[model samples]
Target chain A: MNSFTPDRTSFEARLHKIGDERYHDKHPFHHLLHSGGCTPDQVRAWVINRYYYQSRIPMKDAAFLSRVTDPALRRSWRRRIEDHDGTEDGTGGIHRWLRLAEGVGLDPDYVSSARGVLPATRFAVDAYVRFVRDEPMLPAVASSLTELFAPKIHKDRIAGLLEHYEFANSDTISYFQHRLSEAPKDVAFGLEWVLDHAVTKADQDAAANALIFKTEVLWAQLDALYSAYVSPARIPPGAWQPGEGLLQ
Target chain B: MNSFTPDRTSFEARLHKIGDERYHDKHPFHHLLHSGGCTPDQVRAWVINRYYYQSRIPMKDAAFLSRVTDPALRRSWRRRIEDHDGTEDGTGGIHRWLRLAEGVGLDPDYVSSARGVLPATRFAVDAYVRFVRDEPMLPAVASSLTELFAPKIHKDRIAGLLEHYEFANSDTISYFQHRLSEAPKDVAFGLEWVLDHAVTKADQDAAANALIFKTEVLWAQLDALYSAYVSPARIPPGAWQPGEGLLQ
Candidate 1:
C-alpha cells in the first residue's frame, strides 16, 4: 500500500462521509417530498424523474456486469439487475415504482414510456450508465456505494410518504419498502468489494470520487425537479407539464 | 423512396422547422444571455458551464470521425476537430472561449480544468459525445444539424455581448465571431449530408429526432445554468459556485 493510503477503517469512514455530506437525502427536493410540503404535481414530477433513475439502475448494473471478468463478481452484480427489472415484467423495483406513479395520479404507461422525463434527468441517469460502461471497474464499483446511503433514505421515504400523502399506501410505496431490504443486502457486498479493492491511495481517491459522482447524479435529478416543478418553476420545453400524463 | 418520403425541398424544410421550434436559441436563458441581462456571476456561471460544452466539441467530432468508414467523410469531418482544438495551443474555438472566460474575470486555467462544471452540463455534453460514438452514422450526422441554427445565435450573441456587456470585445468574443463564418461552412456540409442520406420516412424521422435530441443537449445546458444561477437559483452541490475560479 502507498504511504497516503488510509487504513481500511478510515477509508470506509471517508466513503460514508461523502454520503453524509453529499447524498440526495440532503437535497431540499427530498425535504419537501418527505415533509408533505410537495404539491401533488411535485410528487408526480418526482415519480416521473425518479422512475428514470430507477429504470436505469439495472442497465448500469448490467453494464458493470458485462465488464466483470470474474464469475463471482458477475454473479453478485447480476442480482442488482434482477432487483430492478425483476424475473418478469410487472414486478421488480421499476414496476413497483410505476405503482407509486399510479398512486400519485400519473399514468403508469406514460411514466413507463419516459416521454416526459426532463433532459437533465435523462442526461444524469444516462451518465451513470456510461460511467459504469466505460470507467475502470474500481471506480465503477465504488459508484454503487451510494447504495451505502440508500437504506436510510428508503426508510425515511417509506415513513414520510405513509404519514404525509394519501398516495402513500403499502402498494404505492412498495418500491421503497422493497429497497429497504434490497439496498442493505446489496450495499454490504458493494462496500466490502470497494474497501477490499481500493488498496492504493489513488484507488481510494478514485473510489471516493466515483461515489461523489453518484451523489451528484442523484442530487442533479432533484435539482432539475426542483427547478422545473417546485419553485420559480421554469419547465424546460418537452418535459412533463402539469396536467399531462394523468391517469384518467 | 418510400411512399412517405418527402421531396428534398420539403425534407430540408422539416429539418429547419425543428430548429425554428426546438433550438436552444429559443430558450429563455439565451434570451437573457444575448440581451446582457445576466449578472456578472451569471455570466461567469455561463462561462464555466458553457466551457464544458465547447471543450467537448472536438471529442464529439473525433468520436464521430472514429466511426466513419469512408475516407471522404473522415476527411470532411477532420476540419471540426481542427476548428475546436486548433493546430496548436492558444488557438482554436476553445481557446477563444477561454479568452471570453478571462474577459469575464474567470481564470482561464480554471475554466479549462472543468472542475466546477454542473453535473447536468457534464452529462449533457458527454451525452453528445456518446451519441456520436454509439449511434448509427445517419442520426449521428443528423445530430450536428443544430449547427444550422448556430449562425443566427452567434450573430445575435456577438451583437448582444457588444451592446450589453463590458467584457465583450473583438478578442473576447472571437469564438462567436469565428463561428459566424465557421458554422455556416460546417452546417452547409452537415445539412447536405443529412438531407442526402435521410431518404426514407423512417430515416427522416430518426434524423429529425436526432436533431431534436441535439437541441435538447444544447438547451439542457442552459436549463442547468438557469436553474443554478437564474431565478430561484439552487446550485447543485458540486457545481461552480459564484465566487470560485475568479482571476486575480
Candidate 2:
C-alpha cells in the first residue's frame, strides 16, 4: 500500500481540483441554461428535475445528522436541515425551490410532489442521501464540499436567468441568494472538519473521492435533463413531458 | 382516521397489482433482451449493469440481518446472504452472475469491480441497500416482497435466454435457475410475516407502498438501461461503453 501522505495544503488542493474538473457547472446543459439557449419548456424541465435534488438535500443532511454521535457535530449539522426545511411553514430552501418552480410556470404542488421528476434525477439524488447515511463521517463530510463550488454557479444562474427570462426576479431567485450565504458557512466548517480529520493519505483520498462522487451525482442529473429535454429528445417512459404539470 | 382495512386476500391482490403494473418484466428492454432484439453490446451492458444489482443483494440481506433480533427470522434471512455470497469462494449468486458476465464476454473482474456500471444503476441498487438498512423492520421486510413475483420472471428469462442467445447455456443461466427455487422459499416467509404483522389499515398501506417502492427500484434500473443504450443513446459521461471492459 502506498503511504505518501500529503500536508494540509496539498490535500485541500486535491479536493478543490476535483471540483475544478468534475463540477456540474461545466456541464453543457448548464452552458445552455446560463447562456440563454434553453427554451421555456427546457427551463421548466430543469426546474422540475432539479427540484428532486433540492428536496433531498435536507433528507441527506438529516441522514448524516442521524449518524453523528458527537453532539458538536450534530449541532453543526442540524443547521443544514434547518436551512433547507426552515423553522416554520413556507420558509427555507425547499419552499423557495417550489417558488422557483412556480415562477418557471410549473405547479408548486407538482414540483413538491416530485411525481414528474426523471428517474435518473431521483436515483442520483437518492444516492447522495444514501451516501451520507452509509459512508464514514470523514468522507460524508467531504462530499458536502460541493457547496464550496456552489456560490459561483448560483451567481451565474441568477445573472443569466434574470437577463434571459421574464419570470426571473429577486423573489423567484431567493433560494439561490439564500444559498450563497448559507453554503459558504456550511462548506467552511465542513472543509475544515475534513482537513482536520483526514490526516492520513488514505483518508485524504477517500475524502477526495467522496467529493468526486458528489459531483458525479450532480452532473448526472443535468445529463439526464439535457438528454430528455434537448436534441434527439428520447425521454424515457414516464418522465415529465413538455406540457405536463404546468401552472395555468 | 379512516379504518378501511383490506383483509389478507385483498392485500395480497393489491401487492400483485403493483407487480402487474410496475415490474421490470413489463419493461420493453426486458422484452428486447428476452426476445434477442438486443445487440451483443447491449446484452453486455445489461450483464455489466445487472451484475452490480446481483453483487449487492447479499449486502442488502446482510444489512437486514444485522437489525434482526429474532433468531428464527435471522436464521431464515441468513440463508439469503449465504445463497448470494456462497459458503466459499467460486460459488454463490454473485459468482454465478460473474459467470454470466464472462459468458457475455465481459471481464469478471471488471463486472465485479463495478467500475463501469451506470450511475443510475449504482444509485438504484444503493437505494435498495439503504432502504433495507434504515427503514422499520416491517417495511424493510415488506420491500423484499418483490421476490414474490420473481420466480416466473426467472423461469421466463432462463427459457428465453436459452432459446435466444448463444451464450445462454446452463452454466451462464444457472443464477436464474437457482433463484427460481430460492426466491419462492424466501418470499413465502416474507409474505407470511408481512401478512401476519401488518394488521391495521395504516400498516397494510405502508406495506403495500413498500412493495410499490421495490417495484419502482426494479423498474427504474431497466428505464436507465433503455434510455442510455437504446433509443437516442445518450450514454452518460462515465458509464460503461461497448467494448470498453470486455475480456480477450
Candidate 3:
C-alpha cells in the first residue's frame, strides 16, 4: 500500500529486479546443485520435482494464451506452448525435462503424471495459474519475467547437473539445452508485452508484484525439496522418497 | 511400496510416531508460535495467515460431507461445520479467530475475507480441500487427524499467546480456547471412525496416507510462511508483506 511509484523505467527493469532479488537463481540448492555439492539423490529429486514445474510452464502459458484475443499476441505466446509441449509427441520442453528425469534415473511417466511431485511444488505451480485467472492481465504477463533469469540458471543447472551427476546423459538434458535458446526469446517477447502495456505507476507496481509471485512459485518448490530430501524427516504422502527403492 | 503389513497396534503407533517426528508440532515456528517465543508482529502474521486455514476447514469438510450419503456420518461431520460457521452471526470458530486477529492488530474484516493472507497459505489449504473432494470418504475423515493434535497445541497456543504477547486479550484467544475443547472431541470421533473402518492393510495404509496428507498441508503452510516471511526473498504477490499495509 506504499503508493510509492517509479516513473517509466521500462517496467521490465522492475520485473527484472524482482528476479534479481527473489529468483531461484540465488537459491542455495542451485549452487550446491551446480557445483556438484548435492547428493545424487538430491540431484534426482531436483530433476524429478522440477519436471512437474517444467511440464506446467507450457500449460500455464497455454492458459494465459487462451485468455488473449489478439491473434498476434496469441501467436507470440504460443511459442511457449510449443517449447514445452513440442510439435507432436515426445519432444518439447516437457520431453527434454523427461530426459532430465530419465538421465537422473526417474520414470518419465511418473514425472508427467506428477504423482510424486512435492506438495509445495504442486501448490506453487497451481498458484501461478490461479494468479493469472484471479488478477489483471498485465500482472499475469509480468509474472513470466522469472523467465528473465531462467537462461542463466538453466545453463548453470545443465552444466552442473552433467558435471556432478554420473547417471545423467546429455539426451536427458535436452530440456535445459533447449531452454537456453527458447527462454530468452520468450522472456524478450513477454517483457516487451509487459513494458508496452504497463504505463502507470500502478502498472509498474503490478509488474513488480507479478514477478514476486513467480519467484515464490519457484522458491516454494525448493523449500519443499530441502525440507523433504535434505534437512527433513517427512516427505509427505505420495511424494517421491529418495530412499524408496533399490534404485537409490 | 513398503508392503510390510503392520498390525493395527504397530500401524497406529508408528503413525503417531510420525506425528511426533514429521508433524508441524516439530516445526520451529509452530513451537515459537504456540510457546509464545514469536514477536507480536510474528504472532499477528500467524493469526492472519492461520485464519485462512481455520475458515476453510469447515467448508472443505462440508464439500466432502455433501458427497457422503451416510446419515450417521453426515451427522458426525456436521459438527465441524457448526464448529466453524457457528449457529448465528459472530459465533463459532471464525468469529473467535477474528478476535485473535484483532488481538494482533489486524482488522476483522480483512481476516475473515483472507485479504492479507499469503498466497502459499491459500494454495496449501485449497489443495487439502481438493484432496478431500477428490478422494474417498475414509481419507477425507483421515485428513482430520491434525485436529487430534490441535487441541493440545491450541491449549499451549492460547495460554502462551495470551501470557507472552503484548497485544493479546482473553477475548482474542477465544478461538483457540474453543478449539482446545472442541478438537479433541472431534478428533477422537474421527480416529475411532477410521480405525474401525480401515480393516484391510491397504485401507490402513491409506488412512496413514491421509494423515500424512494433512500433516503436509499444515507443514506446507508453514513452509510457505518460512520462505515468504522467514526468508523474505520469496514473498509472493497478493500476500501480506511486512512494513507494508496488509492489502494487495
Each prediction's DockQ?
Answer: 0.01, 0.01, 0.01
For model 3, give the TM-score of chain B: 0.91
List the pairs of residues colliding in candidate 1: none
In the range B93-129, model 2's lDDT, one tens digit per residue, is 8789889989989898888778888999989988998
TM-score of 3: 0.49
lDDT of 3 by residue, A1-248 (tens): 13465545645566667778899888887778889888868877887788767666654664564345333454456567556656555556766776666676666666666677788888898888668645789988988888888888877887787787786567867777887898899888888887788777777777888889789988998888888888764678888877542123
lDDT of 1 by residue, B1-248 (tens): 96778988998999899999999898998999898899999999999999888877766775665444333455566567657766455777888998999999999989888989999999998899889878998999999989888888888999999999998999999999999888888989998888889999999999999999999999899999999899779999988888899999
Question: How do the residues A29-116 of candidate 1 rate in per-residue lDDT, one tens digit apiece?
Answer: 9999899899999999999988888777765765565455333454456567657766554767888988889898999889978889
TM-score preference between candidates 1 and 3, better one: 1
Candidate 2 regions with alpha-carbon error over 4 angstroms: A1-3, B1-133, B137-248
Evaluated at residue A76, the lDDT of candidate 3 is 59
